[model samples]
Target: TFKYVDTDHDGVMVKGELAAVFDYLDVDHDGKLSYAEYTKYDGASAESQLTHDVFNHFDTNKDGFLQRTEYVDTLFSQMDHNGDGQVTRHDYDHFFTNVVHHEMHQGHNGR
Candidate 1:
């Protein structure tokens, strides 16, 4: 699941990873995930864990919404592919492409 979802293998998750999950779960592409996608993919485990993990990490100040720092820092790390601490759109697209490929393989592998 991590391999399929982690995209660039940077040991963390970014928008690409989240978008992959969302795309899988948001079959209707309504810009949000719903129960239908969960059941469709048999992703109960991933859904539950994703919910829990998101709450634990993004809620750094225990606030409901993510702060700018938390959101940027979390996604910025992997987006900075060169480790220079700045992220360009290329980094994002590259990671996203990997995410899509990985997900395709996972679906083919039946896990």
Candidate 2:
């Protein structure tokens, strides 16, 4: 995971490397992120067509953008089981595993 962000392999995530991630996410290259682009997962595990619902969940204010307040606060809150406003490695591991498992279960059931 760290390696994904640290493209230089120097154990550091410089601004350029991180910017590349953002650019990749912005498929249209318009420099603005739409909910559709932001949640478009390219993994072939499943159709993942339901991911747009995640944008609606995060966009509590009906705005077209997923503001940091809603995205960071709500998402981290879900992952931060202890409610300490921070997600530890343990929290991330469990949260990620559960998310993957849930997605897989849903995919199997849906298909």
Candidate 3:
């Protein structure tokens, strides 16, 4: 999930991109992602829920706070959609776009 969002794969999800993801999930615009904000991004669909699930999974192992490895690994798994251990900007953009749309939809529905 982090890899999908983290295009540079620098081991940390950037504020700009992370903020985008948060905006998508934080339907209420509360400026932070609570469990509910996180849940809004999750679902049964792979495209919709993969990144969010991976984020949550990583968070659980390390105090529910995401460090660089957790961020990178989550993103790496997402960008490496084919599981070939590499990623391109196309993958990152695609995933990010999806998340943004998903978040917008959630916000509309929540309202």
Ranking by TM-score: 2, 3, 1
Pick the winner on TM-score between candidates 1 and 2.
2
- Measured against the true structure, the TM-scores of the candidates, in listed sequence, are 0.34, 0.45, 0.37
Candidate 2 lDDT, tens digit per residue, 42-106? 44122354455455556668878655555555656766687765455566667557764576567
- Mind giving the per-residue lDDT tens digits that candidate 3 earns over 1-111? 546456467754444565466557666664444554465553424345544554465564645545444444565576556675545566556666785456656755886
Model 3 residue 53 CA deviation in Å = 13
Better of 1 and 3 by lDDT: 3
- Model 3 lDDT on a 0 to 1 scale: 0.55
What is candidate 1's lDDT per residue for 12-101, written digit by digit as tens? 555556556556666666554333444455344545644444334444566544444444455456556778654445666774467434
- Top-scoring candidate (TM-score): 2
TM-score of 1: 0.34
Top-down lDDT ranking: 2, 3, 1
Clashing pairs in 2: none
Off by over 4 Å in 3: 1-64, 103-111
Of the two candidates 2 and 3, the one with more favorable lDDT, higher being better, is: 2
Which of candidates 1 and 2 is the stronger one according to lDDT? 2
RMSD of 3: 10.9
